[model samples]
Target: MPELENNFYNKNLKPLARNMRNDSTKAEIRLWCEILSGKRMLGYGFRRQRPVGNYIADFLCKELMLIVEVDGYSHNFKMEEDVKRDAQLQALGFTTLRFSDREVMQDIENVWRTLEFWIFEGENSLS
Candidate 1:
């Protein structure tokens, strides 16, 4: 079982992180991490540079099955790709959220507030 899980991680996650290593969103990613470090909004423990099937997310909360992506202006051109990816993730029962780099970098407190609201709102709604 351990070997199987190890193989799965290598096949699915490691490659994706490799591709995102020099990604353009690093600064925004760091800012998000900083905000997440002390926040209770993650709903569970937050993992940085987490690997899921064939992908690497900027932030992941396994218990919440949540993936947060911070997009730069360039993401406007990749709506189709994002849609496709989100669909697959949703099909797997993950809730995905996206915030623009500008939002996180310029006014990060707002980002934390929004995330906190979403986390508690979702929990209350589900209950």
Candidate 2:
């Protein structure tokens, strides 16, 4: 595994990230436990509340440079900010996948399929 640059992992965010993990939203918990944890997503590892640049991603797959975000109710009003944040992450070579709280809560199977499709497409592009 290639070492991630120091800038991508902000030490100052460690405490905040930990707190977020401890108090995860329902959607976050479901996604992590069911799909992301223990390399369950096609054997790809994921870290929850991982700090990247100045932002904390809900779930990060370092090997794939993928960041999965579970947005809750407040996200509806922060769409612009989210877009900009995603752009910044993209500049850092991370693909951001955003899902609403309702989507993850009510239709997780679809979410899994979406993630699987993205991973397969990404792998194919690499090959």
Candidate 3:
């Protein structure tokens, strides 16, 4: 049935994998998991490379419309592309936040604090 197939397809949309193999995105993910384990994270789950519109975002919480990007050395070569994608996401009512790999790895606590505050700010603004 078409309905059954649709349901099955939706169920298969697993955003992130737990045990990352050769992903260069692992460091940011590990730091995020540590932050999440500490209850520093809010409604947004750490979704690795979630596809939104035509862009594949690093981490996106669909419910909150919040996108988190952990920029690495590679991103330096794609600033213009990133900016265009970010503009499209913003137009779709999503707020994008970016943190560098060094920032997340060397200053994790601050990253957590900033992420928490942003999430809370989103919540508070809604009411």
Candidate 4:
């Protein structure tokens, strides 16, 4: 993973990211508490509401150069923005995986399985 530099850090966005962390959405809270927090996922670490470049990633794993986005209803109208955000993250050497609120809220186990496969296996194959 590329080291984060001053150019990538936007001071203004930190506060927003911190605020989002404190007042997390239901799906974000659930995903964090249940699956991603506490150095989980084969010892990989994840940060919630992490500021990456100009956008804040829902969940970021620096070691794996991965960003997991948990999309809610608002995302329905933001396909173009999401595509741009993914491209920006990809330019910074991160691959993003997006999941829906219903998927996370209803079948988190399958989400976990997909994440596990992506992180530990699929990413390697892609490389």
TM-score rank, highest first?
2, 4, 1, 3
Q: For model 4, which pairs clash?
A: none
Q: List TM-score per model, in order.
A: 0.76, 0.97, 0.73, 0.90
Which residue pairs show backbone clashes in model 3? none
Comparing candidate 1 with candidate 4, which one achieves the higher TM-score?
Answer: 4
* RMSD value for candidate 4: 2.1
Give Cα distance to truth, residue 78, candidate 3, Å: 1.9
TM-score, structure 1 vs. true: 0.76
**Poorest 10 consecutive residues of model 2 by lDDT?**
1-10
Q: All candidates' lDDT scores?
A: 0.70, 0.95, 0.69, 0.87
Q: In angstroms, how far off is 99's CA in candidate 3?
A: 0.5
Compose the digit string of candidate 3's lDDT tens values, residues 38-59. Answer: 4447645555555566666666
Q: Which ranges of candidate 2 are over 4 A from the true structure?
A: none
Superior by lDDT: candidate 1 or candidate 2: 2
* Candidate 1 ranges with C-alpha deviation above 4 Å: 1-10, 15-26, 38-43
Best by lDDT: 2
Candidate 1 residue lDDT tens string, 13-120: 665676665463755556555765445455366766667656667776766777888888888999998898888767666788888888887878887787788788
lDDT of 3 at 70: 85
By lDDT, the candidates rank as 2, 4, 1, 3
TM-score, prediction 3: 0.73
Off by over 4 Å in 4: 5-7, 122-127
The total of clashing pairs for model 4 equals 0
lDDT of 4 by residue, 32-90 (tens): 88999998787889988888899999998887888999999999999999999999989
